[model samples]
Target: MALCEARLEEKARFLCRGRNPSDATDLLQDTYERAFRAFHTYDRNAPPLPWLASILTRRFLDMCRQDKRHPQQQLTESLDVPSEEAGPAEVWAGYTLEDVWRAVDLLPEEFRDVVRLKDMEGLAYAEISQRLGIPAMTVGTRLFRARKKLKELLLKKAETGGAS
Candidate 1:
């Protein structure tokens, strides 16, 4: 319990990286409560962090669904943005990591999960599959598509003179 409490903030931040801080806090608390209640069921030999992460991820997804924050809305908004015609220099001028993360947040849930697992979390493909409960091949496909979409988005930003 003390160990879980110590890691609460880190887990919350991981679960809510692109979300409102308040939402993150709520989810984190819920995750801890859930984890504590189910701690007895957890296999002692298995990796606790990943198990906790998986639980939190599912909880977060449920929250999103309950809140009715449709991924389709984000997808529509992203698709509406016109691509930029500028070169790489103009495209990367104001490209802070936060901006990149915001772009990642705009991705559809499936693609966004892959990007977060692979890029932000630095998990291997196999690990990502286990965490996401998807096949390894699906992880690869989602990652490829997510990268392509992010590239397109950044290019659009550059072309629209909004890169900076």
Candidate 2:
């Protein structure tokens, strides 16, 4: 409980990586409750924050699935109808943010962390290395590998017409 209280804000911010910013608070509370219920299963040797963050990540994915099933009507949807002024630009099939993140989530942990920090959070290699206690070169290398793997995954998804 004390650990949960101490890391609540940090976990919420992490959850916001894959969730609506406004829903962070509710998601954080949900994380706490779920964590408490699963406390007995927690490994004492494992670090708490990452474990909590993983739980929140799963919760965020669940919420995303839920939202997709019951999509909200957008007020700006009517404005999005194709207009005469819209040029015939090449239009690729749309992939939701969930699709992109789901691919990212499929990445190996070391690759995923650097990709998220550098690409999603917009951190520099030096900053990511410093925060993660790794070499800057390592950060760059991992990010490169991560992007390559992501591209492969997306390409495969496109080719197979799979839900990403």
Candidate 3:
């Protein structure tokens, strides 16, 4: 574990390839949690970097699969793709990461946790259910509602010019 911690930046940079730089931190976090939970299976003779890297790769793949299962279209996609002239909704064009996260932080705790686990940590609904001790159906339901709420909040933020 100490070895893994010592090489955190190295591992995170490796995880960043083919992904958003922001995802690397969350992927690294999930990998560390998984590694700690499965520490008993680690081979003491082998090096830590390769083992940790393998776990990180699996986590990224899992994240990809999860994303495929729940493909939330990017908020700006419509604005960016359509060749139409800008209108009132043109305000939706520039939602930064900070705006999304700020909106997320304002969500009620239950909704917030669901979003963070499923979206930020790249956890599957089942894993989120287990982590939060909720039924799988509830995880799905909460995630749906949370996403709806996030969209509303973000749109409001965009309309208001990035105000909280």
Task: Please give, for residues 1-164, the per-residue lDDT of candidate 1 as tens digits.
Answer: 56865576677777666444566788877887898999999999986877787788889889766544444333323333334533444345457666777888889999999987766655678999999999999998998889788877877776677764
Tens-place lDDT digits, model 3, residues 1-164: 77767587566767565344566788888998999999999998998888888888899889777665653332223223322233344454566556777778999999999988866676778898999999999998997788678777766666666643
List ranges where model 3 is wrong by over 4 Å.
Answer: 1-89
Whole-model lDDT, model 2: 0.67
- Residue 72 miss distance in model 1 (angstroms): 27
Clash totals, every prediction:
3, 0, 0
- What C-alpha RMSD separates each model from the true structure? 11.7, 14.2, 12.0
TM-score-superior candidate, 1 or 3? 3
Clashing pairs in 1: 84-156, 84-159, 85-159
* TM-scores for all predictions: 0.46, 0.43, 0.48
Angstrom error of the Cα, residue 25, model 1: value is 45
Instruction: Report the lDDT tens digits of candidate 2 across residue range 32-146.
Output: 7999999999998987878888888888788656554443211012112223443111112344556667888999999988877765665767899999999999997897788
Candidate 3: clashing pairs of residues: none
